[model samples]
Target: MATGPAKDEKCCLVAVTLDKDTIGQGPPDVEHERRVAIYDLLEKNRFVLRDYADEGPYNLRLQIIDRKLVLAVDRQDGVPLITHILSLTPLRRIVRDYFLICESYYAAIRTAMPSQIEAIDVGRRGLHDEGSHLLIERLKGKIEVDFETARRLFTLISVLLWKGQGR
Candidate 1:
């Protein structure tokens, strides 16, 4: 009887976990966002290791360990595949800027005119796109994922990083 991750949880290795101990369930809204991101990512994503493509569907665990973002990849049956450690330093500014613009956008939506909301939204989307690209570049040599996958992953990262949670 091998004791480890169950056999039934295997769904082409698309499962992703963000160490609940580290990230917590978060506030209600944040938790909801995280759940949505996970559901959307698993519903459809293209995640493949640069060299270990054949050994997937890969289960991914995203966590901030030792103050660095850690991407631990493994087979569904719990076999270790590859792990990628990325510095949070590169993304700190972008995520910070993203959050700032998000606050402005949220505030504008309730009080500002339609055109003001639209402008803020445009900036928000731009920052989102930029963060996605930066994540892709950071994972360039280690993993192969589509832009959408990167976008979804960035959303999860953003959630985990929300308001002092990165520490």
Candidate 2:
């Protein structure tokens, strides 16, 4: 059995990269969200790949290739680990719904009544939670991530899926 990180040791992302071509096509808001998510994820996150012996601080490069989400992971020293590919098909509907609710929430914050804004915000959070849960489920065997980490990753994924469409 492979030994994982120590209980008190936190496995964090040392570097993160997104596909310039695809992410560049996203709007300003997508860029903003991606920046925030990357910052938050690197600041603190729990990520472990089971059955692997390498130690990390890891580096991750994310991209959408042929309708699949590809994660090219490496050790801090640039040693390659595994390139994990997950289908974006399962996440399409949830990402679309989350983006729609987010748009509503942002618009409501600008002009809607206080109660309406709160309601929209609540819905937005709910969808966000759902997306996070779905991500965790999908990554079950390949990688292990804490809920907070998954939530932040979900934000990044959502941002990548701009225009309410899969990347």
Candidate 3:
């Protein structure tokens, strides 16, 4: 499988795999969040590989190995392309904070006033943005993804982290 995309070629993620052995079984809400993130990512995303032939609709497999996040990219026909191993250490704090904020947001939605819910949502989105930016920075030179794509990927990563923690 080619590693680079062609000139001006646009690529998108078509599939995702999360290793159940490492991540374990998540709760219903976590599973739902994972599904939604993947669906949204597939629905709309711009992913490009540097110095490689541009071909689209890549399949990605996510796994945690030795406390690192492994992103494996493959072709439509299941041919392997490239694998990016990112340190999970940088993501730990943000993921933890994001989950805490999400929990508060959900709780606020259940009983807090509209303003309260909105406030909490704002925090959650901010944390999400931070995490997305970190993801982009971490993936720099390995792969390129737009803000929305990184956001969705960040969501998935958060889910993986949560599941990895057995929470």
Candidate 4:
């Protein structure tokens, strides 16, 4: 499998890997085009994705403030892709490890379903204080960013991911 890093400034992790057995694949450009297609879509939608260069079959977890956005694709069908939102209610430390397992599963499934090309937000639930609740509500209907304030919010929320992880 070929793994490479993404060049986006805001992304901290981005990678594309294929089954090792599938050597001399269809065309190198297939992966490239697929990557570009996904990246372009996220960029067009204003969602910032991090890029990381590592081995195959890893989970993509994006921490936005007090929320851990975890993406998981099915192992065979690649359909019914799941995105888990772990509310950093108190934030924990075990998130990184759990996130890895999540990625591994996604990577394995990605091999079987080459035709799967859809993403669905399974569900979202969280714990929050009054202020956080207000902010979360505001962030619900639509996505908006206030740069300076959002930067702080993201930092705070990201920290919350590890708060209750028995660290």
| C-alpha lDDT score of every prediction, in listed order | 0.77, 0.77, 0.80, 0.33
Ten contiguous residues minimizing lDDT sum, candidate 4: 117-126
Q: RMSD of candidate 1 to the true fold?
A: 4.7
Q: What are the models' TM-scores?
A: 0.83, 0.87, 0.88, 0.20
Candidate numbers, best TM-score first, in rank order: 3, 2, 1, 4
- What TM-score number comes out for model 3? 0.88
Q: Kindly give the number of clashing pairs for every candidate.
A: 1, 0, 7, 25
Q: Tens-digit lDDT track for model 1 on 62-124? A: 888776888899886579988889999999899889878877886797799999999999999
lDDT by residue (tens digit), candidate 2, 48-111 = 7764535666777777888788888887667888999999988888888888887787778789
Give the C-alpha miss distance for residue 48 in model 4, angstroms.
Answer: 14
Candidate 1 positional error at 66, Å = 2.3
Global Cα lDDT for candidate 4: 0.33
Task: Assess the local accuracy of residue 61 in candidate 3 as a C-alpha lDDT between 0 and 100.
Answer: 85
List, residue by residue over 27-124, the lDDT tens digit for candidate 3.
77777888888777777777776654465557788888889999988775678888889899998999999988988887787899999999999999
RMSD of each: 4.7, 5.0, 4.2, 16.5
In model 4, which runs have C-alpha deviations exceeding 4 angstroms? Answer: 1-38, 46-87, 90-101, 104-138, 141-167
The number of the candidate with the highest lDDT is 3
